[model samples]
Target chain A: MFNIFKLAARNLRRYKRRTLLTSILITLGVVAVLLFVSVSGSFKAMMIGQITDSMLGHLQVHSRGYLSSIDSLPLHLNMKGEQVVRVKEILDGNDAVEAYSMRIRLGAMFSNFTETTNVRLNAVDPEQEMQTVPMLADRIIKGKKEGLLAKGEILVPELIARGMKVKIGDTIVLVATNKHGSVNGQPFVVRGILEGISGPGGRDGFIHTDDALALLRIEGREISEIAIRLNEMEQMHEVFDELKGQLESSRNKMDKPVFEVHTWEELSPFFNIARMIDLMTLFIKIMLVAIVLVSIMNVMVMAVYERINEIGTIAAIGTGPGKILSLFVAEGFLLGLFGTLIGVVISLITIAGMNAAQISFDFGRQKGLLLSPTIASGEVIVIAGIVIAIAVLGSLQPAWKAAGMDPITALRHV
Target chain B: MTLVTAKGLEKTYIAGDITVRAIRGVDFTIEPASFVCFIGPSGSGKSTLLNMIGCLDPPTSGFLEVAGKDVTHLGAKESARFRGDHIGFIFQDFNLIPVLTVFENIEYPLQMVQNWPALKRKQRVNELLEAVAMKDQGGKFPNQISGGQKQRVAVARALVTNASLVLADEPTANLDTETANRIISLMKQMRDEFGTTFIFSTHDHRVVKSAEKIFTLEDGKLQQQGNGDNHV
Candidate 1:
């Protein structure tokens, strides 16, 4: 076996130019794949972080029919106070739950004295909401990041703030209709202006939960939704499953399930874009496979064709068919190994250089967000394994043809 | 005892609708350590007979034995193993692996086929290199060496495994007359030193003159068999 490998290496060296060219082709393919994966992976991670950490959290719990009518912020479908307490108990007891914020979602009329417009609002406990969505404070492009909001003060969306000419310290009136046929209004000062996110929740305003209760004249501690954060985002599905299993069994007096659980993927439109990035990454990988397959196969076939007489001599002198096959395959395997090694080294250096350069770009209203591209070691291993395997697969046909050659005919092949 | 025996040996190749008989029924025996030559014109069954006798090809119909084993109907793999264990081959082109140095080419049979140990294989290759007077050319690749030197390396390679029988098909076809005679003499000397049977096919009268026994083939049939001068 060692002799076979030695011979195979020498054979590759015999055609130095061809071997180098094929190796370069494979190396470029590998570098392209690794770099694309790292950059696109960074983009996806940043996008998800913006949506989840600033708005949705990792997952959320809502009243059974609430999400279907979530666009309208239906007040009658809010989880009653008892259901909130039950859900709170489940969240508190689960180790995976990092923090959760209970919100009162409502539609209101906003007027900055001269201008009036419809605004969607989320009333939250400032401390809990901060803990669940830590980046929420970072989204405040103007005004206070510290307290988020105080009672009788609101954080207006940037679009609304711009349109209504509302600013920090500007007093605004919010009018709302309760579950009953009653209307109420409250005046509040703007504490901050939020940078708008890209999707559905981008235009919503924020206020203190106490102010929402007072404005709506709610009799009990009913809440519209619970936004949950987990210690590890990768475990979102497991935690969602565990929590949903428990919550799904909890019924109202009418014997119907009371809540629905959703991951941030389901709640955000940005996820489709994330999936498209993933699909593009897959297509890049397929392209890498095709590149390796064609290049290695072409080189191996040529090697066999050019060395037919040598193959015949060896076969006639007692080298077996299996040995011939392995010799060619080993050459291909070495090609892949060398190319992958070079490509991985170059890719890592390129990624490091990107980080050192501190590349930054904007997504939606988030600006100067630095892009830090990274690849997991497992991903590198998998990609390298795929290239080497494909190289071997590509060499099979040519190697088999060499192995099956009749020495008499091969010697006369010229 | 005979190293090779063939009774009514024949070979036929079929291509599309054509059936070509390259070797007609013929019988022969070769004694161990003997120098034998087959002299024939083109398409006179010289290479076909040698291929069958070397176990590189199985006869279509015959009773054939080499070193006491019937090889007329051996399977492809078994035939390859048989060839590896019992025979060595040298080609007219001095078909050395171009990538390998002369020493490595000579060591190939032992290393690839017989699974010889490194030290022993090195010793055997060195001995053959010395015997073939290519001791100084061990590190030169085929193209880097002269045709005579390359043929010398081929001779060394064929004897490296101590094979009981060595087959050469037109071993001197590419060499000058003097070089051809020298290669033939070296092959005979190796046969004497290793006690190995050497069977070769050639159109060179000089090569046939040095052979102890010669068989003449005409139209796929052995027309005559005798001592070198008598047969000619």
Candidate 2:
């Protein structure tokens, strides 16, 4: 059986020109798929990491309607005092949850004596917010990044500060409308200036939750949402399930979930763009499979055609059909193996070149991101396995023809 | 003992709606270790009869047995197994696997059918390579060798399996007279040593002259059976 494989390998070398051409196609297809998958995979990881670590966190648990009507910044949709305690207790109990931050999101007007601007403000606990969004405080350009704002103080984004002519330690008025339609105002010192983000929720201001409560007529304890950070991104689904079960089990029967859970992908439209990259990569791989299948099949069929007399001779010499099939199929298999091995080597060199090139593209609030193409050993194994299997499958028809041939008739074929 | 017995064999096939009768009503008995030849001109079904005796193609209507087993009606797989177990074939073109070295071509049958142990297979192939005068040429591929050397490798390959019957279909057709005569002599010497029955289908008079028993065929039917002049 093993000797049959040796003969098949030798046969490939015998038809050097034909084998080389088919193998080049296989090598090209494998290399294209490997490079594309690696580059796209790295790009996805980077973009998702940027979005999650910068603002969204790994996942978010918000009071129902808060995320859906997040644009309207409805204070009435905020989680109630006891509801906040229940959510916090559930989050604290989950091992997957690395950190959680509570926030009161509100629509506010910022003014520095003369001019005013509408701003979406996140009234956050400074310490927890910084921990949940690891890069949030790093975006602050002035004053302190860690201890962002004190009572009666606000953190204004640089764009907003420049527009309103406000600076760190400058006094500003925080004006808000309560749930009762009552307008209220308070004074705050600007503690830090944050860099303006570039996406949908980019232009925002930050203040202490106490300042937010002081500005708004809130009856009891409440927060707009809780953004959660998990130890690992893969833990999102398990944690979301456990957290949702904990929250729902405590609720009355037949009542809807008090909160809607969203993974980072759900929080922004940007993740979908990342997913589109994967879809495009998959389509390209499918094309590679098609090319390999057609090219190898065509070559093997021609091989069988040219070797009709040889086939008959072997059959006449008492080589059975199964061995005959193995003979030809081994040809295809060796073709794939050689090509894939070469392709992998070539892909590694090409990917190294690409990474060294340090290609960059602007994505959301991030710019000049380094492009890193990474191929996991497992991915190379799986893709190579598929290509080789397809190559063998492509050879089955021609091999079968040779195996089932009538020895006398086949010998008579030209 | 009869190594092969064929009685009232008939073969026919459809070709574009016109049925071509390739063999009709043939009967014969062959003894073990005999050097025999079936002589005929073009389209005489000499090759067809050899195919039937070799178990390559089934007879349409006949009782044909080879190596003490009924083989006329064996299916494709069974027939192939039967051929592998009981027969060796030599073609007019030599038909050596081009990719293999001469030794590898001779070893092909042992590996494919006999599952011979590697050392023993090497021994047998080496012995037969020596027997066919290809001992020094075993390292070379068929294309790298001369036509005579290629045919010599083919002969060694045939005898490697120690099959019950060795069938040669116009074995001398592709060779010049000197090479053809040398090949025939080598085959006869091998037969005298191994006692493997050798059958030939040929129009070549050189092969016919060497046969101990000769059957003449014309138009898919046996025309005569006669003893060779030498009868050795």
Superposed by TM-score, candidate 1 places the C-alpha of residue A335 at a distance from the truth, in angstroms, of: 1.9
Model 1, backbone clash pairs (residues 3+ apart or across chains), number: 0
lDDT of 2 by residue, B113-209 (tens): 8798989999999999989987788889888998888888888888888887899988998999999999999899889889999999988888888
TM-score of each prediction: 0.97, 0.95
Question: Chain B TM per candidate, please?
Answer: 0.97, 0.96
When only the first chain is scored, the TM-scores of the models are 0.96, 0.92
Task: Write candidate 1's Cα lDDT for B1-232 as tens digits.
Answer: 7999999988899999999888788889999999999988999999989999998888999799998899988987898898888898888998998888999999988889989999999898999999999999898888899999998998888888888999998999899988988998898888889999999899888778888989888878888898787754
Query: DockQ of each model against the real complex?
Result: 0.85, 0.87
**Candidate 1 chain A, run of 10 with poorest lDDT:** A195-204
Note the Cα lDDT for every prediction shown.
0.92, 0.85
Off by over 4 Å in 1: A253-255
C-alpha RMSD between model 2 and the true structure: 2.1
RMSD, each candidate, Å? Answer: 1.6, 2.1
Best by DockQ: 2
